[model samples]
Target: MSTTKGHADRDVTEDLLDGVAGWGPVLCHLGIFELVPVTFDLGIPLVARWMNDPAVAAYWDLAGPEIRTTRHIRVQLHGDGRSVPCLGVLNGTPMSYWEIYRADLDQLARYYPALPQDTGIHLLIGAPEDRGRGVGGILLRAVTELVLDKRPACRQVVGEPDVRNASSRRVFRKAGFDFVAEVDLLSKRAALMIRDRLTLYPYEIPRFDGYS
Candidate 1:
């Protein structure tokens, strides 16, 4: 159910992500944040360790072994340039994992009214010390702003965090994303969140009646 109409015949040589490797670093309240494109040699072992964390595994479900994480990342690494896996490096340390993709050309398009050049984000804060603080929101804001800044054609940045994960949903809202809807994905019920280019500033905290 991929909505790859205009993109169906796109040249394989053209990057669907518009070269995330060159997006460069952005300054944030936390520190200088950068999205370093993932490589098997550098990303596999680190990501595998994060996946094994109890808090991460409960939702991501890729907890078993390094091979499982390798296979997961390998698919995106070798696939059509629609998705790019990146390591979130803050200041000087790689502390998070992210997947930036074209939502309009993705399976997610089937579940929502997606617009052309819509970008999607998938994130996981890697270390326990970085969790439960304001790190996720700060990094999410920086990355979303980076996406909108680097990809002008992309009018919005979207994410689907598990509905049960109240902390994750709150992080999105704190990052200036509004709750769009509840979508039922294959593995979990997700809370669709969206941050539009039109309202990237003057941050407003969204109010949810009884979401949690």
Candidate 2:
């Protein structure tokens, strides 16, 4: 019964996302220091840094620190008409960075229906010095609020954290994302979490796909 209920919730959430994919704000990156507009040029380098961060690469599918890998991420950023918004995580002190991206609506719809109506948040604490300072929690909320402020079309923000990552799970839950699913993929297990826009800032809740 518990499993069935979980699936039911996910199905409904997906439907909700699909229903609102094209409704509001198109692209915006909300960060601590500034509210920057979205663009491909800004997105590529940030994603390159994210993909190459050893901390992030350890669990993700991307290769580490390779120029070629960065190039590949760059291509993806430009090839797709996706919007990537990156924010430097500075809360009266320096810490790691956080980025949120929106991909082509129809492509996202392939994996999860209604994904076009949302924006996905990917949080990375790559800077070792920033690891234990309670900054992850701050980055999570700030980024979400930023998205809500810039793009009112986003209805929900989603994240996929490995189930083994207890710290991250706590962060997402604190940010108000409910657990939607736990599944095995490419030999690892991960959790699907979503934050509702209505419960979020007052934006229209556009669909977004959560990717690492």
Candidate 3:
């Protein structure tokens, strides 16, 4: 059976995000970017639109016709409870799509030696305006820091960008991940990249008053 079971603890992550304080109080970020969990109450339509955008679909390799509908997104969110659907918001506007998950609970873990603490990322900038402007690198760095900081047990952050996606590889390198050879996965050759926890932050979980 799968180690990952059940659905998202919508109450825990969603309800705990921001209660009586409202949207303003719940707004947290790493520098300029805000990462929010994609909840059923508020994130469904938003993510659906982003996924259907031509530019976003092309960059994310989903350039087909209406492939990522709301239903598809919902099913993806239920993946073993380890996958988290998130949006990268800047100045209250969503700019990117991010899927943060545990590698040990993922099929990708079979491609390499995955530790229980290995967290993986699937990222894509949603807008054409956001791409080619170094936003991917900056966001990736902040995201890596955010993930490593938020999950104390995560010893490393990993990514497997298709080898043909040179831009993504460069962004990963800029965000402190070292290239670890090409691996065949899902019938595509991917470049394995990793960044150990010790390299980014010396402390395991640093105190962040506003953000974690």
Candidate 4:
């Protein structure tokens, strides 16, 4: 795996994600959100359970067992620094899972007009309470901002949610991702969502009355 000097002078590998482990927390409307890099021993069970949720499994399809989810995460954890899996913590609680990757270097590049430094995001709101209440869109926008801010080379953030998953597609749209096209992937047809850095500010998260 590739390594880079990051926060606190640590040798954080996964440079293809531009030192994501060092990006730290971002304060959003909902709460303080952070994308902590995933560790197998601490992450597997929680992630596996989330994968088994019917709503998540419908699109993610990694519903069977812990080993199934383990293998999925293992590939990224052990591969070249093109992807990084993380636990999305909100206000000190790990409530979601995310995979931040280099879309230009992924198999996804074969399907789209991939540009250098095009970041990709794969997310699942793990808890039942966090779903269907605009949390997805809120975090999508927050994470997109993090990518654009932390990875200066990334001009756009992209996602390929299964086309049949309307709720997922809707959240992407609500978060400022433009529906670029429908691409057929090995597993399912996907809606290509792109959030261009050039036009992101208009849809940026708004400040609430009491929040700093």
Candidate 5:
């Protein structure tokens, strides 16, 4: 058990290093435009505004207090045993957000093979005033570059969206993710679509760990 834990830790460290080193040159250029960081608090309102938009909310099935509660942001920022939130800022202003998480594949088993680390990106573009100005696209591109540079070991990143949300699906496709599957929600008829990239990883978590 001790040796296994040690090995895992080492691999994680290596992954982080490889990811960072690979992006070092890009980071220097990114600094000129100032696109950085994956965590944010000042951007909460931006996220709330975009996510709360009726058109946006239509797909999420979130409304009223559920949308108003701080729990969602809290979970997005702190959930999955992470301490820092992954937020993207543009021109010194918060414009997008994402998270790196290790989620239980047991729940995803109906669709994908189990993964040891499941990275995810939840991008939100606020300041509707800035919508279609290329801000969302730029930030997403930057975030993808950031993730690839920061997480070298990640073979794939996963995203789920409402089947009807065309705009978001386009942004994801532009970011290099491929359509993987469509998942049935609680309603059975309504489904969430799944997308992923084939980055490839060296390790995987077994399906039955007996802890869940």
Candidate 6:
């Protein structure tokens, strides 16, 4: 929690991210670009836009007014100390929103066999314009590698997007994820998607200059 003065100092979150010395310089480049934390200031507006759009809002189950959605995003920024709230940035621009959480501590744990090192992900691209250009598959691959690399103990990464979202399921498949099963979650049928660490790295991913 660092001090940021309005939008003028919005980039201040960059400094707070840098100060985590234990993370080392490797974190400065997450596979390709930066996987920076979504700070208080940056999280509010960008998240509001993504969650309120008619095309996307249904995926997140955030309905009613804009203020309700904003509060939901704020609570995540404030109280979600268990997971990493991430911004997938290419060069310096934020391209997507991502969260990497411990499966044992996640709601999905009850539905599936929980493992000590399993990680769960929730993701959505922030811009509606970038929905179906095959950009999502690329972003999914990058974010998956970043999460696996960040957690050395993690052996598998999992996601459950609504089964009704056909395009999202395609992106997961393109990114090398396998469909496990469909489970009822949040009152919607979600397709369980899994990508093993080996699947993300083994012979699947090409060598990136900054990637370990």
Number of clashing pairs per prediction, in order: 0, 19, 0, 0, 9, 0
Question: Model 4, stretches more than 4 Å misplaced?
Answer: 1-12, 202-212
Ranked candidates, highest lDDT first: 4, 1, 3, 6, 2, 5
Residue 152 lDDT in candidate 5: 54
Candidate lDDT scores, in order, read 0.82, 0.52, 0.67, 0.84, 0.46, 0.65
Residue 175 lDDT (model 3): 87
- The order by descending TM-score is 4, 1, 3, 6, 2, 5
Output the TM-score of candidate 3: 0.77
Instruction: Give lDDT tens digits, candidate 5, residues 1-212.
Output: 00011232323533433322123222222232233333344545555666677765675444455346245555433332322234454435555545444322324434566455545555556556765565555555555555544665545566555557677767766556677667764432222333333542233311222222
TM-scores of the candidates in the order shown = 0.88, 0.61, 0.77, 0.89, 0.61, 0.76
Q: Which pairs, if any, clash in model 3?
A: none
Which 10-residue window of candidate 3 scores lowest in summed lDDT? 16-25
Return the number of clashes found in candidate 1.
Answer: 0
lDDT winner, 1 or 3: 1
After best superposition, candidate 2 residue 37: deviation in angstroms?
Answer: 8.5
Residue 137 lDDT in candidate 5: 52
lDDT of 6 by residue, 1-212 (tens): 11112332323323322221123222222334555666666655676667777777778766566677566555544542445567766656776877655666566777877677677777788787777987778777766775676567777878888999998899998878899999887567889888887776563333345533
Of the candidates shown, which would achieve the greatest TM-score relative to the real structure? 4
Instruction: Judge candidate 2 against the unseen true structure and give its global Cα lDDT, from 0 to 1.
Output: 0.52
Candidate 5 TM-score to native: 0.61
Worst 10 residues of 2 by lDDT: 1-10
Residue pairs of candidate 4 with colliding backbone atoms: none
The residue ranges of model 3 lying beyond 4 angstroms of the native Cα positions read 1-5, 8-31, 53-55, 59-67, 201-212
Candidate 2: clashing residue pairs, number: 19
lDDT of 3 by residue, 21-92 (tens): 122212233345666767667566666667667655654544444444554456545644566667777766
